[model samples]
Target: MSTPTQKHTKSRKNIRRGAIRLKKISLANCPKCKKPVKPHTACAFCGSYKGKVVKKVRVPKSLRKSKKQEKSKK
Candidate 1:
């Protein structure tokens, strides 16, 4: 295999890697639940998509905290 004859400059390297850098995740609000969600995907909190119910999600008992518990914590 042949190797590069010349050293790549930092500016050139950076320019080439510019597109490889991490990008911010674009998010859209769920119309039903008003939660941040990825575009074209169902809202995980309410299981909704495009103003319609596409999935039925059941909240587990362990994850559900009562109002009384919240008040006691504070």
Candidate 2:
């Protein structure tokens, strides 16, 4: 029969297992509020996606503009 080679500690075991953490998701900017919003998801604050407003969004006219304006100019 084979005997045990060595023992492992809790801290060493944890380090060997690697850090257990949640993957961060990439968030998109809200068109209406210019706030960070998850992609293909409704805004948590205003609850809006695409053009159709899913929730009430208070957007200022000045902030609203063509994001591709620079590309179009060229």
Candidate 3:
């Protein structure tokens, strides 16, 4: 029966558990659209993989931005 230990501080705990640091994710540039994407994956911007179209990729409606031209009525 031996239970006598000092309390650990927040900074000490964080330093001890430093494994939670974010790991860098490596991304390759898409040849078609020149966008950063994971290797061996289809380009989300151009819907192409390795210079060939593999699937249709579309931007979400919410995120899709378009400019509309307005004409002045005389």
What would the TM-scores of all predictions be? 0.71, 0.45, 0.53
Tens-digit lDDT track of model 2 for 26-64: 988989878998899888767677956777666655555
Q: Candidate 1's residue-wise lDDT over 20-65, tens digit each? A: 9788999999999889999999999999898989999988776666
lDDT tens string, model 3, 1-74? 97749888999999989977787988999987788998887888889988999998877765553322222322
CA RMSD of each candidate after superposition: 5.2, 10.9, 6.4
Model 1 TM-score, all chains together: 0.71
Better of 2 and 3 by lDDT: 3
**Candidate with maximal TM-score:** 1
User: Model 1, residue 67: displacement in angstroms?
Assistant: 11
Best by lDDT: 1
Task: Tell me how many clashing residue pairs each candidate has.
Answer: 0, 0, 0
- State the weakest 10-residue window (summed lDDT) of model 1: 60-69
